[model samples]
Target: MIVTAKQASSHCGGHPAMNSAKPTLPAQILSQTPSTSSITDRLWRHSLYNVLDQQPLDRVNVLGDNSHGHLSCVNTLSWTPDGQMLLSGGDDRTIWRMDPDYDVDYPFVCKSVIQTGHKANIFNAHLLPHSTRIVSVAGDNQVRVFEAAAALAHSQSEPETTYSIDQLDCRVLRCHTNRVKRIVTEDSPDLFLTVAEDGSVRQHDLRVSHTCGPGGSCPAPLIKCQHELSALALSPLSPYQFVVAGESPYGYLFDRRNTGRSFDEEWGSLPPTSGPSIATCVRRFGRKTKPRDDVYGTHITGARMSSHNGHEVLLSYSGDAVYLYSTRDNPQDEDEHHGSSIIPSSQEHRTDVIPIASDESHIDVQLAETNDNEASSPLQRATADQGDLDGSDSDDLTLDAMPWDDPSVPIILPRRRFAGAGNVETVKDVNFLGPEDEFVTSGSDDGNFFIWHKATGELHGIYEGDGSVVNVIEGHPFLPLIAISGIDSTVKLFAPVNHRSEFSRIDKQEDIIRSNSRGSGQLMTRGQLALIRAALSGQELSEGNPCNVQ
Candidate 1:
């Protein structure tokens, strides 16, 4: 069962109970008592101790309001390396640095606000690791860098004061021709990467002017994809390897070392003699067919590498489902010619647009088959074939031996499918939670966030996060805390509290999965999304309102 703030408060009379007290390690467990269990068993036991403590029902603080907080929907929420400060970017074109441990009546308070000069919505903003510098991207197709200290210094007298882009030390880099979707930092503090709707993945070097290449001439991108990209994930274990997915049914893994000059550099330019810059591996989950214009369930919204297991990946599909896959197996073992670089052919470029059922009937049939083959227990089911979980198939392909034009590359299936999370209405984020990264969590369009056991794929908890939709689910770097934001103007922080009841697990899995699949037919256009943002910001729609369908 999902619990909201109003329902929780009503359960304890008219007054809401004080639920800010944090949980502590039991004395017996802290004493290091001898146990016969193996090291792995003990470690797993300890990690799962308070894994479900962070619940949205017990909201510790709400960080936005009409007067001081963001006037629009908060799109991104991230924590500094030190975990002392939280940063949030929104449609309001502002980035706010928040202190979650403030001493005032409210625990979370906006310490500083950077009013960016981007002509469009701020998609993402994050502080550079171990530095005061901040990087942000927006729909204006520009990447901006500013100093957090400068924003704070300017707002010292008035915490709620907004620091305009001109007043603060900032650098605006106009690199991509289209809107930038995501930006990620590498191990180097001076290096960062961005993917844009222009189908280019470019790397930026902070040490140089114009960020990449030389002077002001248009620098070539590292990799120019055939389709517009929306998601990018750098592998935690390999510095040169990353995953890029968007507008496509598959996620491509590429190595930066193998990248050649941008395809846009010269028309009909031949690939390097060494090899074409192509994905080393490709991952496909769900049905192998092209989605119709009305249903974009196959396009990837986000991709993330597991913090603990680099070979493991989590992908969230637009208006569809979430999947977890492993890339540990070598495709070369199956075929001698695997892993060779071949130019994509025209035939390979054309994806088969296989039509599917219009409603939940198809999903019901898939779910029924899944239940028929269920394992004896949750643990056994997790180890069993993952294809049945989402009622969708999975495949992994190594691209070395096949030409890019080949319709078939390779096929490894996903290890797990996180079910019952509805993501049909909005773009949501999926992430791993807990100290050991033992739990998988995602924001849903139903205004609640869902949590699953990382290893078992069991639906563990579902907590109400927003009144409309929950889009971002960011866990604190070290602490047992979670920060969530979506259509609501405020960012909600969740932490463990004693008064909250244990999380209610879903018993009827089929019902929830069916509910999640029911809305797959509805399509949310870009104009509709903008209207939602405008309504949240209390702004009147005018001739300037975006009307394009995504």
Candidate 2:
């Protein structure tokens, strides 16, 4: 997050470029073109998603495999305000913090197992709507609240450090009746939601004086939906409007002020079923209405919205396929989470809310420091960094393949801090890409970069790729560039080639469109021609002899 120049290189042992003097903005905004573009980093063979960012991007962040301790898969990721530290949760049922400091000889190498409470794979980890405290859910059917003070409060000298993720671990909040598949926060820090495998969704209000703190009882949820909830998220645009992903392959979006059952329950909800391969339940976000109608019950295995960006767009990823839709168009299924609901008690359905408490202090102490050296290093350094693959090839000989090629990785979860009208965007299982507005990008199982349209569900541009799937994709906000990790074991940067001259193409396209449009048809198909004339009519493009043909 904080990029500095080589002010004092010797004093800080880091890559020369690592010490950037300062984040320098271009004297003039640059232009972008498909051909004449500039790219910065390439995470080859590391690409896990098939999505990518727009022009002028930077590899501001990078998260590697476990350095503190190894985990099966990374299921959740969250960023700090400064964008410096990244938090993650996964199948290992462990949580961690990743600080990408290029100055350090090795990054992600200096990590801490962090919260050590959940007994099973951590289904989700998140920061409260407006505060620093994080909430994590697990398959163990428990939910725990972890305040930041507790994480940074660790002192090996203290008694808490005795437990380790690898050794005798304990610590974490466990308050749920079934496997917590996912969790999400609402507009107020006190308000949040979590879904479990037990076919239910619980809404929690810190104000609810439940014994969470002598704070009375965490009020019985304002609502409860009896559908088996899988994934959960609060709409970035309108906080009250939230989304939930479930086991039925479809998710739901309902206004907090609306009905008792969530969209998932109303649409021929499925009976709780068990499976080994169903990691996706149903997730949705993005509040901006779209130009078209999204057929109800869109069976999206996975969905994510763009952060801070204005277009309330969401992407849905199914298997090898991906679909993009806007919040407006998907109205039939566009219900709001006014609150949660409760199903009446029945012989088979009657279940008591089971709450368990784990010793989190223990998981943190034992996980200790990273056991291996620089495991974060590229696969090329295999001699020093071996495992996962058994070939005797040296690290240098091993190509960093695209991470998305594998069916295991997840669609990075979006952030909850940003508040604005968002365009709903969804993608089923398109390997890479998180739910941020501007800096978000994704790589597909097929080799291509699905650059998002700033705030809309449109494609900014497309980047061809290697034969393997594409995954690891990221972008920096301060600079005009991005990086992608692919199956080729390489990271590629996409930058603007002719920063100044590329603007010329925009003018060229406008001119071409002005020469073609005669009238608006029954349904105006969005295109270059429509946009050019619209801009000209609005007098926003400039007065003189418009985009000159010559």
Candidate 3:
């Protein structure tokens, strides 16, 4: 599985002595040409040889009950800290633990099922770090933290369904007033954050009892918003900062250091001590078409802190796009500001604060319609340069925002329309993969998981799923594996082709072969690229058009 350059050269007969003879320039070109013109540098760099050589992936096994998985869409998945087992929950209102290392013959069976005390569909589930405990939030508007069951002892008898209620204790915390959308944990297992459809963000301490008062007042939210909040992500590096994106196009950043004030009071011209609001700085993405339309009005499905940069965020929109945004140039960047800094405004702030659009033609119309005062609104004060279409800022835009038409906004770079093959049109969430965050992955409505190179936006290849709309996908923090779920009742696991090929083989011939016309054959799990490289360097290449190295 570990391929080295020396091995590749040896397989190709690429010894220095082989090329010592001075050959004609034309012969050299012919010798170096690849037989498959489609093989380009984009395919080979930073990925496995099988993937680079266009070998399609094979499904090793399915995880479910009686060959059928979750009864409803498996909306979310998370891995145990050890990565040996996974925690999956969704519309089924039940959570289950799956062992990725189970034998191929019984690969799909659940190790145990947690009888989530949830009355409605489960939205997300997470295994607490360094413990045999798990916490889940769902449409029932409750957060339940419970101890997970021990692994079933090996037996000659068939495995029995283990229940959370029988083996472990459970604590249900009534925090949010509406359906909880997402939950994120930081350094402490007892302290975590949750966001709800009611547009409220609350922090809960497990040590505190929910029923402190006679009427049983719910946990107080650290911040509240008017718009329905769909997603929330706490910064991994900074303990006090977090970001929330929702139906509105603007993604707001909050600092716990300055809690107890509303966003408007802190960022707006209102007094700093304004009542009942969370004072925070907000960043807007995209532009409004009409004068009165909400600025950066696109609904954001999800947002997360970038592992690469603490100040940057990855946001998924309601449309077929995602944006990597930087918040380095806030008006509140003064040293005195302990929390979210405010972006200072001026006379030029309005006319210069243009929306990031892809089409240049709209620039003229946008400029014409935008007046000096219009650009100076509270939202325009914090316009960080819309990094180029790829979301990488060129030298940093103190105030320059990128146009919406830029190519880097979507899952694919260079601006290609999404070829979604299933019932869903928009992705619900996306996350970075690997320790370096080398790739970005999202679940598609078409029941497939899509992965793209983070830097170049190159299509890494699709992971197939059962025929159901996939809503959420997450990567193991350190492993090469990914867990995805959607309308199907089961959560599916995917790993690199090389790794899966070593574990199991599907007996059905049709399942072994990829349906895609290109690279349609049994995929090579090991070092097949050395053979391809050897063939290209030897005299076996086609004689025609050697000069065309593209």
For this target, which candidate reaches the highest lDDT against the unseen true structure? 1
> Which model is ahead, 2 or 3, in terms of TM-score?
3
lDDT of 3 at 340: 23
Instruction: Give lDDT tens digits, candidate 2, residues 352-408.
Output: 111221432222111112334444432122122122112222221212111111212
Model 1 CA lDDT for position 303: 81
In model 2, how large is the Cα lDDT of residue 253? Answer: 47
Model 3 accuracy (lDDT, Cα): 0.49
Candidate number with greatest TM-score: 1
Two-way lDDT contest, 1 vs 2, winner: 1
Candidate ranking under TM-score, highest first, comes to 1, 3, 2
TM-scores of the candidates are 0.71, 0.46, 0.60
Error of 3 at 465 (Å): 3.0
lDDT of 3 by residue, 1-550 (tens): 0000000111111112112222111111212323322445224222322332243343433455444346776767776544455667777677766543221211323546677768998887876655655788989888887865343232213343546454667788775778998888876767888889877787777755546323665544666665567788876677687877675545666667665434553564323211244434334433212223223324667777765466656666553345554556443332311122232233212223233334423322221233354333221211211123323322221221222212222111112112121212433687776555666666555456656666655555566555655677766444344566676665555544433332222232122222211121122211123224444455342322100000
Q: Would you give me the overall lDDT of model 1?
A: 0.59
Give the distance in Å from residue 435's predicted Cα in candidate 3 to where it truly belongs: 2.2
Model 3 scores worst on lDDT over the 10 consecutive residues at: 1-10
